[model samples]
Target: MAHGDITHIDIPVSDMARATAFYSGLFGWNIAEMPGFEGYPMWQAPNNISGGGLAPRDDGFEQPRSYVEVDSIDDTIVAAEAAGGSVARAKAPITETSAWAVIVDPDGNHIGLFEGVVGG
Candidate 1:
């Protein structure tokens, strides 16, 4: 499968409101509350070059991880596994069109693969 650029990042926060306010006030970012994303508040930068959302961690995800963009998350996961990597989070659909997954590289480095859909 073809590869895409890393389009977004996800930040794990214990307090969504606090994190949102901090980033918004500090960097003057436009942070919005997106209920459609399972209460994950999203932060969008002014230039729109870099952005991500804040999700509450409940599954032992103590640290935040960076997400890498790819054409097909399944293919990336397969390649990662073949390269002696492990799947931290299986491929899961974010919406009808987009999908994402977390995997550990050969060196146990956490990496995220994100696939953006046309309408997502």
Candidate 2:
């Protein structure tokens, strides 16, 4: 994925099955539970390029958020802080080769930053 491009999205839901059914029927998305992430089902858009996950609404993530691909999560975090944004979640590994971080912008919008590619 290119830097600054929306690489993924996380949609907070109260009921995973219900939300999955609705989204799949409405948009024909391919939603399925990943092997390592059983409870959190991931979805691929009809176009097959864009994808996201359906996570339960929780304390830190109570709303939907999009993830932007970046060259380096640490660098992006620094830049975001310099631009008046605050880190919501420090960099955390998503997989052996991939990681993510959450940041709240100056306008209070939550955004995710993704770095590296799984198995890339």
Candidate 3:
């Protein structure tokens, strides 16, 4: 994804099986667990252009979190802070060429930021 694109959306769930069945049944999404990402099942929309993971619910992740593609995590973090948002999570490595982080908006919404091919 290019800058400003919502790369992925993570929907927090309490019961994996129930949530998976509900979403897959209602949305006709292809939900399945990947090899490396077992407990968290991934769902792909029928269009194949939209997809995200059903994450296990946890503190600060009780609601759906959308990850946006950014040009640089460092710059975004700084910009977010300057814009009244605060860093919820510092930049973390996803792979050799990719990274991700989270920021809390003024309204307390936690949005994710990703850079590179992690969401591709």
Candidate 4:
């Protein structure tokens, strides 16, 4: 995917089992915890392409966050800042080569920026 494309979404939930069962049953979504990620249960829509994780809801993270695939996190941060948005979270590495960050738009909406796959 290219920059600005929405690659994933992170849904914050207070009750993991309840939320997982509800979504999976309501939308026919496949939800399960993946290896290496014990607590975060990932969910995929029926289309098989659309998916994200059901993360534990925490302070300052009460809303569902959409992750956009960016060409570069550093560049995205610069552009977001220039465009009146501010970095809510600094770039955090998913692996040695890939990272993710979150920014708050002018209106205070949280948006996630993902830089490629885990090994990319």
Candidate 5:
């Protein structure tokens, strides 16, 4: 992941099974639910590009958003705030090696920030 690279994406779906079937069928994606993240199934595209999560359509997360990889989640959130963006979600650990955060741009579009696996 690079500083400005679009590293991941997340799509909200009303029906997990239905949405999973549709996307996997249409794009030949391989989606599976991880043990800890049971309800939020992650997907990988055929070309091996990693992006997105099929999240339930609740809690004002009914839209699709892309994540940009950053070297520092805290620094990026600060910069986003300085640039008139607001934090949607604070930086949180996804795993021992990774973390992510969400922010809303000046125009009100949601953007996700990902700090990829650290010190792996």
Candidate 6:
């Protein structure tokens, strides 16, 4: 499995409009509302690669989290645990091809692990 770069991050917001405005002003980001996301809007930053999505949160969606792509979800989980982290969501497929899982690091910060659909 070959690890990919961090493609995007998702920021959960209580109010999408307010969050979007704040980020835009704070970072000078050109945030735009995207299709296929319903009411959620995404920001396209200058750097391009580290851009993030902003979505309205509902019940059961607690904590704003970030995702990091890895070569293998299992390997990443093992390393995180060895370094004092714990898995929040065991490695599982989000779709038939793509998989993702969540973990809490030593400091109790949430992170995500993703395995792409097409590649090994």
Write model 5 residue lDDT over 9-78, tens digit each, in one string.
8999999999999999998989998777889999999888775689888786878989888999999999
Best-matching candidate per TM-score: 2
Which pairs, if any, clash in model 6?
none
> RMSD for each model, in Å, please?
2.3, 1.0, 1.5, 1.1, 1.8, 3.8
Per-prediction TM-score: 0.87, 0.95, 0.93, 0.94, 0.90, 0.68
- Give per-residue lDDT, candidate 3, residue 80: 94
True lDDT of residue 19, candidate 6: 90
lDDT of 3 by residue, 1-120 (tens): 689999899999999999999999999999999876779899999999899999999987898999999999999999999999999999999777788899999999899999998534
lDDT of 1 by residue, 24-78 (tens): 9999889886656668777888897778878787775767777887977888888
Q: In model 1, what is the error at residue 42, expressed in angstroms? A: 0.8
User: Higher lDDT: candidate 3 or 6?
Assistant: 3
Ranking by lDDT: 2, 3, 4, 5, 1, 6
Q: Where does the lowest 10-residue lDDT sum fall in candidate 4?
A: 111-120
Candidate order (TM-score): 2, 4, 3, 5, 1, 6
Candidates in order have lDDT scores of: 0.80, 0.93, 0.92, 0.91, 0.88, 0.77
Q: Which stretches of model 6 miss by more than 4 angstroms? A: 1-4, 33-35, 57-64, 92-97, 117-120
Clash number for candidate 4: 0
On lDDT, the candidate that comes out on top is: 2
Weakest lDDT window of 10 consecutive positions for candidate 6: 1-10
Q: Can you write out model 2's per-residue Cα lDDT over 1-120, one digit (the tens) per residue?
A: 799999999999999889999999999999998778889999999899999999999888888999999999999999999999999999999899999999999999999999999655
Off by over 4 Å in 3: none
Residue 25, candidate 2: C-alpha displacement in angstroms:
1.0
The positional error of residue 77 in candidate 6, measured at the CA in angstroms, is 1.9
Quote model 6's TM-score: 0.68
